[model samples]
Target: MNRSNGGAPHRSITAGTDFLHLAIEEAPGGGKSDWLASRIRLALADGRLPMGSRLPATRVLAGELGVSRGVVTEAYQRLIEDGHLAGRGRNGTIVVGAPAAAPKSPARTAPPLPRSVFAAAPGTDVFDTMRTARARIDLSPGLPDLAAFPRAAWLRTERHVLDHLAASDLGYGDPRGTPALRRAIANWIARNRGIRADPDEVLIVAGTAQTLTLLGRVLRDDGITAVAVEDPGSLGARQHLHNCRLATPPVAVDSEGIRVDELRATGEAAVLLTPAHQFPTGVVLRGSRRSELTRWAREGGGLIIEDDYDAEHRYDRTPVPALRSVLTENVAYAGSVSKLLAPALRIGWVLAPPRYRDALVDAKRFTDLGNAALPQLVLAHFMESGAMERQLRHLRRHHRHRRDAMIKAIGTHLPSAIVHGAAAGLHLTITFDAEFADTELAAMALARDVKVHPLSWHSQRAHRPGLVLGYAASTPSDIGEGVETLGEVLRRGGAGPGFVR
Candidate 1:
């Protein structure tokens, strides 16, 4: 009698398949199919073979395991009968179901975030927390029409860059940024904002946030202890400066933008400003005030950190030249695509005065080895190819319509509310004569699943009760509905006395 006919393996021999490492020697005498089925079930229970995973062909697995085809076929049939898998003709077997998963331990789960995030003074992580909070409508400021991101144009430019990329381009890039993107940024600001700069003057950063961070460090190192910020300025920017251990002495902002007089009164060596389009307030720096600010920077020896954010998103006015254009020696200008494009790109540029230029570059060199080279190259191509200009024109048209719809809705619903910053930027600030806290209104609105920032969150001084509502990211219908909901919330006395909805 031949042992081959009986299919009994010798004690010295063993057979195994790569599919789950199935071993014929591990099967009981004359129970190969049973053992194989048990192994698959174990794999399913432990999540090794997840749902929708395709199994190897029975014939191929059988050959690998040195088993007869019938054994593999029978094993597959067992799993099929158990509803763990299904077979498609010529498509091989696939996992169609998995065993119920074991329950996770209570200790392994994260605790829910507190709902009091909007109740008190917002911490540094407040924005991070709010972003993750659940809500039906997000009217958060500092966001553009994210849905309008030019994916096709970006992809086309990305592909073009990749096709023509040099092998050396993949290595470590310039800590300051790629020359292509720097040149593109230089030309971009020149044409759009009237700022003259060489590509070498541009230092690509993560975003305006990083610009503040790096500047804060460099300023502090240079014996600067304070940077005066607009009273109703960006709380996030103020927080960034504060985190860098710099005191943010608040300077009042009136209709003429930041008060140059009060900024000088602060006696700080440097000041941060949103001059072209002031954050939250949306007031443009007037000509006289601009001149005064220039005099302060040039004559008073005060450094100006100009955040030229959202200068290109104007609707009802001609563009204002960036402060860097006239006070190039005293001003450090920063801009980013966060307001123009989406913030997710994490791309921005800083043009510091020659005094601080080397320090900023050194700070960037040690921080993340510069932004990823591919995106820098792609964005450079996008801007150089005139695609960014076209995108800006398209965003202006789209944002204008949304801004109009929001103004209309505010008028129809909250007639008593005073809307500010409507002339430009992605958001509008509406103030109320009510005595209630804006944080209370924000919390109430959040309770109704509408997200917004309390005006007080952006103001460090005593300011009017208001809310900052963004229109650029939402549809007309959503904006209308969100404003209507806010109206309803106010009518319910959420805004306290003197508020008329």
Candidate 2:
């Protein structure tokens, strides 16, 4: 019998096991089982061996460590008794328990956002801060009914895609986008937005925000300095352009959409417009204004960036054709599922003029190497299968009930406030005739746990004080409570003497 091996190895200076680099040398002469149990406990505490991870067999590990079988068996038995592992007979040992994670240090925790965020002039991070701020009732615009996201449909589509996905398809995809999604988008836009485009011409992007950033870079390279934006337009969009060092000269927007004459007067070669349903105001661009805008683009060599957001959520009005449908040569059309499905998807498409198409693709290549391939494929299938159409129809019916609820609440509680853009879209804009700071009202309402966007935040020039309130995500009961709370806040703060009826 090899009596020396029963105690310890004399010839080897360093005996070790390959699994988790377990070193037998680190154990005391008679404490091998204790050291092994300690190392395993540490591994479990630090998450190296998570629950359900299969461990090496006692015999195999004993051979690897040049230890007797009984030594390894004793060590595993200790962990099994401690409930950190379980013996599964032929399945070997499996990790069954782990220590609770240590609490984070106070220094590592982020401080709560300050209320002054609403008081200060809107900055690039203003929206980011407001989103993180605590609130019980959020009426922030530009959000759809997120609770209604089609999780079942998405999961089913995702499973089908993964089941049929090729190994090669997992590699880097086309910078332009997957051809399946491009073709699907072409068909989708033609049917819904009235924009007929070749699948080859479509460029997939992260969202409308990325669309602005990429276009800003490309337009700068092409020697364009400034892009006019509608006054009281999307402040977030304006901020993206400003971050790219492009000046956003303000052009007034009225009931008929952006003032093309004011846009031309700015002397900027390019303009960004949300014509289908203008932000905050929610007015459609009249046909005559569309003609003037087209003439500006064709005759004056202007570029139009059409943001067709939320056009699919109409309640009362007929569908408006996308601007890209009319002016193919100079219009750069952008649309996203942010308003249709959820903003978390970050999927949008861009159709640029022939001159900017190639440059835009190159910009996309360097920006993030194109959007993820699988989601594009999944969305493509969802659209082609008529699931997207079904989703739209469902959202239309669901949102209409909530919209009507909000309208009724406003009429009952805030009758003095005049509402705009209620015929279609996810939100309504209400303006007060009397003078008061809308931001102050918003801050006070937020203090009562109600969140809203001050209308002045979107405007570069003077405008009537208002609030943009979204109803799509809230239940009818909550909508009623929130509007009633706003009325209570208004009465307590004595907003503008009294809101004009």
Candidate 2 residue pairs in backbone clash: none
Q: How accurate locally is residue 72 in candidate 2, as Cα lDDT from 0 to 100?
A: 79
Give the per-residue lDDT of model 2 (tens digit) for 111-186.
4344456656666377567645766577888877665788768888988999999898889989989999999999
Query: Where does candidate 2 have its weakest 10-residue lDDT segment?
Result: 5-14
Off by over 4 Å in 1: 1-117, 124-132, 494-501
| Cα RMSD (angstroms) for every candidate in the order listed | 15.6, 16.4
* lDDT (Cα, tens digit) per residue for candidate 1, span 1-501: 112222232121112255476777899989999999888887777877766666777777788878899998998887774457766555457676665444465341334333455645656377567645766578888867665788768988999999999999999989999999999999999999999999999999999999999999999899999999998989889889989999999999999888888888888989999998898899999999998988888887889999987899999988899999999899999999887778999999999999999999999998788999999999999999999999999888878888998999999999999999988889999999867767767766776667888898889899989999998877665688889998888888834333333
Q: How does each model score on lDDT? A: 0.83, 0.83
Q: What local lDDT does model 1 show for residue 130?
A: 60
